[model samples]
Target: MSASCPISRDSESIKKLVDNNIGGVVAKTISITPALVPRPSIAIVDRGLGRFYVLNTVKPGEIRVESTDHLNVRFIYSILNAESWSDISFEHYLEREYPIAIKYCRENNVRFFASIGYKPEELSILGPRVEKIGVDAIEFSTHYIGRDYKPIVDSAKALRESVSIPIFAKISPFTPNISELVRELEKIGVDGIVATNTIGPALSIDVETGLPILGGSYGYGWMSGPALKPLSLAIVAEIARNTKLPVIGVGGIVRGVDVIEYFMVGASAVQLCSIALIEGPGVFKRILSEVEYWLKTHGYSSILDIKGISLKYLKPEPRRTWSTPPVVDEKKCIGCGFCQQVCVYDAVKIDLIGNKRIASIDQTKCYGCGLCTTICPTRAIRFLEQDLFI
Candidate 1:
């Protein structure tokens, strides 16, 4: 959440923002009366595009785990790390808002999931409320998953005992060791796990002002966008490798190829945040369409076919096999001596042959990692994989 966003001060604007997000939730989850898009296969967020074109393009998937804002005064105050929520009546506003969203999803025939998040201490109070709301599923998330995460685990276990619906947990990605935490959630039978919540307390600055761009209690705020893709991918990949929990991949996913990459690493599905905010809802159409195109071209029919397929290729270290060395094509070499300077294995040697300065590779010393091939300005080096495999 951006500090300068309208939700901080404007009630109408905040409500409207919430409503749009609800609409996106609906469009993504269920049918809109006349049909919002071509096939209703992709998720078009209500708040992001506010139009039919955007909502119509979501990729077809199941009713995702959803977590609603913990709308109490303290909750709002704390999430933004604001001074207080004195301006908004927590109960009156949420009562007025949540039902309307529920009604919309119900009428639209969408299987909606309601989610809630707050400090772990507030779990007992919110647990009953989560049970009361009539949603298809429940998702529990919190910003506090640091060194002491026992509270989060306890809260999920408590919710599991009472809530009849399928449950999901959204854990923070910042934790150093999440494997054991995931193991505990799996032990208690969490339906799935959203490998992360937004990562931050990150800061973005204006070079001219030498100040932060977002507003918050501190200048720091959470970060979302393609920049987060690597972090999200690592979390999801780690969990997939170690546990059975179904993972919903998120972070910096901006294209159809990214979605496929998430699948290759072992995400059952992916969540869109930055892309939806950046490109609007229409991005779904482009992504899903391209995903379909890629599937067909690759001789695969479903995204599931490629899920975790790349895990087989994952290795802790690169193979150190001796293979063909990068041979400098003397005719093509510009004699820049870039390869000589870059060769970590001390392989490249530049020699003055007759009148011309020429470059050559010492095949004996070249381990075939091929770093020199990429550095060669004249395309004189070839880093072929077949030679490395040999």
Candidate 2:
């Protein structure tokens, strides 16, 4: 069992001790190596109520991890990182370059996370090795295949036993009961939870070709964009409400405002998968600056001041109430009358307002169902809800 490339002579004795207490009947084995240098470490651990901290020392790995105390974290999947690389180069990347990149993150103090697919053993081998090689944290992202989630639960437990580094499990919104999963993760000793990963065997196709735009054999690729904000936010809010484990919210986070939205729902930190690819890392600084400005202007000391403030408003069910109808902004409106066409209630009428023809919505006739707003091509329709009580 010790034959797989021991890091040092002491590793053999360490393996002997670890073997006595097997972490279940796990398939993979990791050769844990002693850290050459003892450095300051920080872990994004759950401090209850879904809050987290970058603490000075973590006891799990015993050897302090060299990481920044900052709560900000970034994630990249090996599949995404290796998409276009040649096999030899990809192998080299898996063996050395990727670990080197993780080392860079550790040295620079950026929280490092590498997300894995369904396989648990991948974490088992890489977790301790990276801890030894110098990455601070690891994340597990899995999609639930069937009703049975035992494999997912077992994988996390196996990794927990195999490595001492903080494990942040990314919750899939597709799961029937995310709160239940959160509790299971808590029991398995997951250091924290990442509120989401992308959903779907979804497809985006060319109109002319009737084939996927993703440009591969498969017609569908994983779908994620600004469209995912609501779904991801719901998961973050649900997990935050149900469990005390800290959440790293993700999905469709294109702006700093989006980050605040996640934090307000109790995400301790966050990750952006798709937007970072589109806008690049410069977005991080821009977001932090925007959040800082917004918080300071509002008399909050820092971003932390606003975190989870919205949790109180997240109810088990949305309040039942009547909303006001959509209003048309004449300045930006093209006077297409698309909204008027779609208004089933006949609440809209076209009129020559000044020189332009515009759609007018009658508040008395409008039920505030807001269907006309959705069909507006000119985006002239504005949907304003009356005050909560109104």
Candidate 3:
């Protein structure tokens, strides 16, 4: 019994010594700078909008993902087929499209935005699904083909009030006083406005068969891609000039240059439908890369710097006349005779004996249309500056 008591007392003394030593060491280390301590490699995962996280033991050579909100891309669900209206169940269609869009956004690191079909009542069903999938925003078609905008605006306001997510209203170009409509929407506390949904029941007819392309007035579909760039620019420029709310530019964005143009006109972001449909999703990567390259070349750190650069230069100026039409180099000309055939006014003549085609512009007949320059296969012709008024 005496021997056991000694062992117990010895253990207690040892514990006291260890605690005192540890306390002394901690006190002495208090003056050590944090920078002197080696830290474990941390992986930073960015989920956008000032959100990030640190992960221990990051994989080798992992690239840190940066936020791309400044160059945000929105996916537009343009109803290409009427079956989407009735034949397909709305719930099923939404389910299919939502996953496709969400996956695309996740892979590309861009925001997902969609316009619900133009029915107000359908929002009760569609809105929940969109929000459930973590969609950043939802857009509503505010202007019907021939209907007044009052009902659309009212419905949009109601939806905006009901939904927790941001609401956008896509206004048509045909709407009278579109700027006024945008202002009214802003007053209703809408998150954003998309201007000029589609131009109108655009028509293309086969002259030989004398028939409509889509049959029986397909009613105006949205015009987009290269052809609509100028129109989109004008609409976006107007909205940018007037409104304080964010503007999402759509229509006719085919290349990175187009995207820059839209931003210059005051679009917070740009959306593309037709170009994606025409060129496929791969176009997004090309566009993004080209945009980044252009930004770097122009000494810009971000897209924000170049945005609205053209606003100051928007004032109208007198048009200048070219001094002369383009002249073809006789030595470089291969005598293809393409320019001769393209000239409508017989301004170009091919000298078969000399084996050389000479283009002599008769000032009276020459309209300066530049049709010949376009027909030249070789880069032998260029428009020389001319100061003639047609």
Candidate 4:
């Protein structure tokens, strides 16, 4: 579970996660003084199937809305929220939340991690206190802190000196020179890394009301969900490649295959937020089932069997040769014209073969831009290029 997720908001919600077989829970982030969360804080950007937008050139800088009935053309899932840290005070968590969480987790054999944040002084004060509660670990976030490494390094040092328990730094994606930062944290005795928090100081507006939806200072919030996967995955891979410490992948994990992907890329574990909020607690059980089935069918006995497998194959340079064009599999082609629609080179065409329509490619016209191969709903188009660099 992730900080700021409703499921991690309270002890009761955390129990739901544990009962659903979640390995561990990170309590919502708290600071010495309670944070002021904005009203109408969260808004879901679920632009479901067949919706697309176009830039209206006639009125420069204006966006025009468009729609279609295509079944396979759904957009990504995203959410914008002005959610701040835990509304409850740090003292309240220390006096009430931590003790209860520690007891419950001990009884259930689950690990409890307390997430705390803010300046070095605040972290120095909170660290020893949370450790006294017998938390399995302490995760401090770098949410409002600037991207500069000095402040973070200082905070990590302070927290490290304040407690003897394992400490994890929840990092923001905006931090530059991640490898260098990771090295510094490792030197300072930080035990592990949480590769991401959320991706931005992003904004969302309501065209109807001509005002921002969220009530934060600028209605800005960090982005999370399916769209955040690519960036977060890259960060996880980079961190895992550079450090010996465990990396917990966060952001945009919605399915069992996603967990497999994280493991393959070197993540020791993962955290879920948006999906849990959208689908509720049962998602944990459902995804775990999916992971089990996938592992069994794939001939893998455990997640450890595939961990860090992709790191060995990483290449630093781009391919230099032109590869073969895509090949069409007649059995898989539905002739939906999607390939033809997306092909900029006019290399694909639909032809009536027997009673069915099928897609065919003109090798002469294809520049191997690969638009059709990706757009084909049935994966009918494919490339057989083996080792382009070779």
Best candidate according to lDDT: 4
Off by over 4 Å in 1: 1-94, 106-111, 321-390
Q: Flag clash pairs in model 2.
A: 327-382
Q: Report the C-alpha lDDT of model 2 over 212-255, residue by residue, as the tens digit.
A: 55543364344455667799998899988988888878777766
Which parts of model 2 are misplaced by more than 4 Å? 1-95, 215-217, 321-361, 370-386
Q: TM-score of every model?
A: 0.63, 0.65, 0.58, 0.89
Please give the distance, in angstroms, between residue 267's alpha carbon in candidate 3 and its true position after superposition.
Answer: 1.0
**Residue 216 displacement (Å), model 3:** 4.8
Q: With candidate 2 superimposed using the best TM-score fit, by how many Å does residue 332's alpha carbon deviate from the native?
A: 12
lDDT of 2 at 301: 87
lDDT of 2 at 145: 50
Give the better candidate number (3 or 4) by TM-score: 4
Ranking by lDDT: 4, 1, 2, 3
Using TM-score as the measure, what is the rank order of every candidate, best first? 4, 2, 1, 3
Of 1 and 3, the candidate ahead on lDDT is: 1
Model 3, residue pairs in steric clash: 201-220, 225-252, 264-308, 322-386, 322-387, 323-385, 323-386, 323-387, 324-385, 324-386
Q: Relative to the true structure, how large is the alpha-carbon lDDT of every model?
A: 0.59, 0.56, 0.54, 0.82
lDDT of predicted model 4? 0.82
Off by more than 4 A, model 3: 1-87, 94-108, 143-148, 216-222, 316-390
Name model 4 segments beyond 4 Å from true.
1-4, 48-76, 144-147, 321-323, 385-389
